[model samples]
Target: MTVENTAEATEVGETTEVTDTTEVPAPVEDAQIERALEAILMVADEPMSVVTLATAVGAPVKRVRAALAAIVADFDGEGGGVRRGFELREVGGGWRIYVREEFDHVVADYVLQQNPTKLSQAALETLAVIAYKQPISRGAIASIRAVNVDSVVRTLLGRGLITELFTDSETGAINYGTTDLLLSQLGINSIDELPKISPLLADGADGFEGDVR
Candidate 1:
């Protein structure tokens, strides 16, 4: 009787195991992931990688990739929706939102006309850094100046003084260079015509703490 009862208990334990529920994290909905991605990209100054997005939204990389595709398509109006004035673009193995090229003229005209005031002191300094270091990234400019250059960079770009040359595939940094408008305004034929900095500084390296050029 004891052996029979033990066997019966073992069978009941197996049955209970089958009925028990083990909780696992539910899969994050794709729509939720898409919204999260958009929210992050909206204010991002730099393009974000898929791994970064996944970590941010607590979703798998695969889901983030799928959501990115949806966002790209939606912005392009591939799903029969109205095309957005801006678009999600992938550059340097990451993604960011950019103003659509088709409407560049309109934005440029508004920016140029709405603010005809001279460049601020901050803008001038930032511009000087870019002038000396052509194809420099915003972070590098900020690091050298020891201040934020987001608005200043925007102003330079809006004024057509600087332009994006290329993005670093490894670091995902966008390098900027002088534009023709800037050269024209400066009465120079090329970037090489810009004057030297050592003569202007107190000590070629004093004020900047080092040779910026």
Candidate 2:
């Protein structure tokens, strides 16, 4: 006689795993997000997207967008606050900090009257990027440098090292190039006279023809 298998029959040593996969959102603080955004924007060279800011600060996009709005309002002197010289502005499909229109001359004067001291290491690095990649936008230079190059670029321009080559009609961004003054100082006739990049570093690339001992 064989035992009949029924619906209640269970196999020995068989087990079932029931997992709770419900995703719980992390805690969000609007004020904290605003502060984080401020810090990031301070160093950012280009306008930042809400999604990008959200990912950087590990917050929701909705919260980041709201935080950006609040920042704009705060800088605009809304809710009985003092107006700021710099404002958070939306442009070129992203958000960035910009000086108020009325404060433009003040910033310009400050940049022009800066002491003629030696270029800072930051300026040197930014200049190198511009040299290697001529006709590059300020945003691109900043992207390569991984920091805001606004002040440095202005300094370079003031020092006659770099000049605005052209403006993008679509984005309105000014692309920069090393000027004749830069070439004169470097003793190079043309930008192509700059040394090839692969020769400078040591034993990094197999294709590099440098004599690396």
* Winner by lDDT: 1
Show pairs that collide, candidate 2. Answer: none
Q: Compose the digit string of candidate 1's lDDT tens values, residues 1-213.
A: 121212222564563222334465554565688888999999887789999999888898988899999999999889689889999998899899988977866776677787789999999999999988777899889988999999999889888788788898777789998877778879999888888787888778643544555
The 0-to-1 C-alpha lDDT of every candidate, in the order given, reads 0.82, 0.76
Stretches off by above 4 angstroms in model 2 are: 1-28, 118-154, 157-213
What are the TM-scores, per candidate, against the unseen true structure?
0.69, 0.49
Top candidate by TM-score: 1
lDDT of 2 by residue, 42-153 (tens): 8776677788888888888888888998999999999999999999987656777877768655654565457557789999988888887777898888776789988999
**Clash count per candidate:** 0, 0
Model 2 compared with the native: what TM-score?
0.49
